[model samples]
Target: MECAAVSAPVSSHPPPSQINTSPEGKKPPEHLRRIIGEPPGPIVALLTRGVWALLTALSPAARDALARFVGNLAYTLGIRRKVALDNLAQAMPEKSEAERRAIARGAYITMARVVVESLPAGDRMTPDWDKQGIEGEEAWAALKAHVATGKGVLLATAHFGNWELVGQMLIRFGVPLNALVRPLKGALNTRIAENRLGAGAGLIYPKGAIQEITDAVNRGESAFMLLDQALPAKAAVFVPFFGRLASTTPAMAVAAERTGAPVFVVMGVRPPGPGARFRLEVEGPIPAPKPGEFADPITEHTARVTAALERAIRRHPEQWLWLHRRWKVQPPAALVTAPSPGLTSGPAPESAPKV
Candidate 1:
């Protein structure tokens, strides 16, 4: 059982505490530390732009190959390797460490492939859902029902699975969608926008996407939001995920509360087969908040979505993204869940023990 190398545990040897310990300046609690944080800054934006430009300039074959190469290299170097394995260990508490590490490696490789596969135009993209094991009958039915009523629909998704195909699949299957996205920093952002829109789906920028979402619902257009990432302190809710508390955004729940539109959770799965074929699966209106509760739908919807994502990750432990710092910060008091027995109060476990 081989595991990639990662930084020492935050528990065994505390890295410099990100929180301020000064008495005059109130120190943020453990939970609050994980919840609030910002995305990459201007310098990060610049690097992303450079990468995006380089990737876009490559030929399709070259791009795909590069994706595969990156995945392989990540596994060898063990960069964020522990993060991926630790996440898997939590997601699948019953699995052996060896099995969990295998899954994490596979997931990294698959994500790399997905990044490139999403590069081609809708028509040019290969590995159709039908061939890849995508059984979207239920989602299609739900889409038709909402479209017929002319009330609009919200499709909530996460970083899990091959989500890139949602828009393409929707278009090919007769459900055109408008997706909401966090605009990327530089050139990468520009290319992602172009490539994504090239598939015939409408996209709204996240900074001021609220109005667009409202308008889309009013106009009866479907919308998609990747809601699995951690949220800012004021906007997050700590939810039980894989027996651990994780800060989650409540946007999906809030959207449903406001629009009266149905919610459909969708994921792109990598089918069990040869080279790297994938599938798309759609599940549930998953029961949104009842008639009365409307104050914080983001927290509510986020919990439901996180629960669903946990289930999916457990099913395909190796396909989820583990490289990214999904749990970099902790949530505040209002957002924290009841503490688990073994989890210490100071900081999250840097390296989880295998079952």
Candidate 2:
């Protein structure tokens, strides 16, 4: 079934403000040599395409079974097992060791599934919303309302679930999206760009995407990016994530403040069972900073969105990408001692409502 139709008169574009750019470092010199052990891009692309072809030929159930097998193999062999387990321990210390291990195992399986699902395998895997889809009514309504205003939205998402599918789903629902992604090596990057375009979404690379993103939003188009990755201390704001202070990018908050766009957190979840359909969850127009609301509105806005993401992850802990070192960057003693107003230093109570 389709979402309830939302209608609003398109409004005039707001005057552009100085864009806030991401704190990405300069590119390395072209003369720099490729690191040893890295394969050529074309070879990697060919192998990737071969794997995709094999996976695509299987029925959805069979593909899921294969993914589970791979995930279990990886976990049993201790491939990045320590990293995932450590992240889980830090994030969910309340859980018993056995419980955390189970979550990690599930995470590995989900990660494998995500890799296969994200591949560019033509239309075989495109979601048929009418037959196999569930939407969060309140969150969907909020997204439609924001889009109705004709001011493009800033979508803050994470690596949780099948994030690539979320964009495709939105396109099906008539929302145009441009996602900011870090370029991969060689032909792999080109393949991904083609896949995103093939799925009806636009691409914005991070090196110089600020101006392009700003223009797109002002023209009433949404921009999407992952807000769950770690950033260097200088380019990040300390925010509470999983009961610890983690470095988070403030790009979405800055863009929203400058362009008068609302921010929303969207994710896609795969339910239990073989060949399960995806459930799309949206949360926000996360409260923006009012005039003189705090000493550092950017920090406050970043924290609010981060908290929303944490809640989403808690709901389906197994679906999140726990393999990465999410809390690698720490704040200095001075900033930790003098935390920003309205930003909590303690972990969230266990009873917080799930998204």
Clashing residue pair totals per candidate (backbone < 3 A) = 12, 0
- Top-scoring candidate (TM-score): 2
Candidate 1 worst ten-residue window by lDDT? 1-10
Model 2 regions more than 4 Å off: 1-40, 124-136, 186-190, 345-355
TM-score of 2: 0.83
Q: Over all chains combined, what TM-score does candidate 1 have?
A: 0.72
lDDT of each: 0.57, 0.69
The prediction achieving the highest lDDT against the true structure is 2
TM-score of each: 0.72, 0.83
lDDT of model 1 at position 253: 68
| Per-residue alpha-carbon lDDT of candidate 1 for residues 1-355, written as tens digits (9 for 90 to 100) | 0000001211132112311111122221222122112345678867776665665566655765777688888888988888887777666778888887788778787777766655443233443334554445555465567765755687877676566665555544445456766545443345445555555556665555566667777765667777667667567666666766666666666677777677776676766543334566565666665555644445555566666666656667667777666675586654454432222222212111111
lDDT of 2 at 167: 68
